[model samples]
Target: MRQYQAVEETGMSINKKIRHIENTIVLSPSFKQAIAMIRECHERSKLTTEPKCMLLIGNTGYGKTTIANHYVGQYARVVSKDGTTVPVFYSMIPSNATIKGLACRLLEDLGDPLYDRGTTINMTSRLCRLIKECKVELIILDEFQHLIDRDSDRVLRSTADWLKDVLNRTKVPIVLMGMPNANSILTVNPQLMRRFANICELKAFNWNPVKERDDFLRFLIMIEKATFFPQPSILHSNEIALRIFCATKGVVSYIKKLISKAAEIAYVKNLDRVTTEALALAYNDELALSNTMSNPFLVDHENLNIPSLEQSFHNSSDAARHGGKRRVAEILRR
Candidate 1:
């Protein structure tokens, strides 16, 4: 019997199967390493001395925030005689964030309802007291890149300095996660850079080189195993692997999105397996890449202009923003 049939025989509902497919976390090697590092930092924070900080840098949709959330979830809050003890606190740095704004956000995350009304000094003091009281071992600042202000050097520098002060006061480890450009925030601030000397980068998969290709293929197999359909998908096939890579550019988020959408399409159409045609439809629906000539899954491999196709994929958002005018221009020129 097919995998989906077996699952259905065991009384698994279609919605449950689809939920499993959507929630699957295929932990790559880098994800495992990052989790380990987070644990190490948490352990180090128990010591009386100041804990070393970590900066996690990655491109958008590269799983930085997901990994952070995963690690923090592992150390969820515990109740003690004093109050609720949150081992790890997670907060997102708001866009155009200032020192006071960040302090208020952190306070709010720690359960201070009136955090928004306090002065910077009052908020900082209250935050430090709450951290100690709640026994927060680690602080994870997601979208740390937002702390940087391109227009105001003073605000940027002050924000970094404020972070340094928070670390000094709390004596807890902090993990800063954001896109690659966030690294510039550290480079410009010597003190902050020195404090967060340890950095971990989560990078997208690459197609070139034999090992990377093999790893990518293995990842495809993992995805296939995780997905449930009436019949097995040929995602592990060599041709499909190339097509998937071309469509997603080896980004894990994009790969998951493509597979999930394809599975949904198969279910809706009463298709037995996820086919190249289904993938093309998913790409069109999810990513808005409708040009059959540019779609790797729809075209002959030898005729595929990979560089041009990648450029088009990158520009897909811009094309949508401008109402596909640029996309039409490119197609007509071609």
Candidate 2:
């Protein structure tokens, strides 16, 4: 009975730490900049007849969604004399996003019960009308890269044209958030290219000694403060911080995971604080890094295993960017 109680307590304690990290987003410098830029776009959107569009591009787990949520929180939906006034309208591009699916998604966000019931044109008219009726100042669409996944040129062009028509009809400033390759959707259609003049990006932290390192450490410190388990987190310490950077490649989500995993290990074992051993074990479990030598927490790092800023930002397909296919070929041959 006592053993079962101890196990339950351990699970509960670790779960609290994980939940704390998951629920709270500790804003990084890039995250703050993205927010500022979005605010600027919102302000600029209000004053002009020709609405300015912003393309917010980032890799997975870079906190682009968090920025969008933050903006939406600031200008909440309100009941007014006329009707509901939604300063910001936010939705995601639907999976297998066709023209009709896109319209239905927008209609659904605008509170239409039978969103899926309308034809493409019917839903488009409804969306435009709601934007005007609700006095919506900005429209934010996330996961826009869904339009590109496994699509042919003809379908891509059709979807792009549909988006252009929406922009023309609504005349509301829009923020399109997607993965880095999402720019391809714009490049395919020059009309969209012209609409989206302002571009913002959220990126992982780099291993620069002067500015970036301090920024990363500060961000980690903030996250550590938020975790409910204990204090004096060793994650912000110099050596551990560098190892974390190497492990996560400075990606915000990966960093949070590593810290949370380490916290779990510490909590379950009744340790007071996170340790390198806990971190090492977490590193092995969380990441798919097959190279044992590259395990930052376990191995003594001679140098940071981070890619250059230029290399990280290079535009390429995922398959092209990763060379793991060669290893697969070798394994098959054996």
**Top TM-score prediction, candidate number:** 1
Q: Count the backbone clashes (under 3 Å) in each candidate.
A: 0, 0
Q: lDDT for each of the candidates?
A: 0.78, 0.77
- Residue range 1-334, candidate 1, lDDT tens digits: 3544544553556677678777888777788889888787878768648697899999989999899889877887887667889888999998878888888888888888798977898889999999998888889999988877756633377888888998998888999999888888888888888888889998777655557666777787788776665567879676687778778878888998898888777766666678889998888887655233477677665544445344654666765565434543443233
Query: lDDT of model 2 at residue 332?
Result: 23
* Candidate 1 colliding pairs, count: 0
Residue 88, model 1: lDDT of 89
How many clashes show up in model 2?
0
Query: How well does model 1 score by local distance difference test?
Result: 0.78
Q: What stretches of model 1 exceed 4 Å from their correct place?
A: 1-14, 79-81, 150-155, 289-293, 308-334
Residue 333 of model 2, lDDT score: 33
Candidate 2 lDDT tens digits, 162-243: 8888889888888999998888888888889999978998878875544887788888888787654444765777677777
The TM-score between candidate 1 and the true structure equals: 0.85
TM-score of every prediction relative to native: 0.85, 0.83
Instruction: Determine the C-alpha RMSD for candidate 1 after optimal superposition of all C-alphas.
Output: 7.4
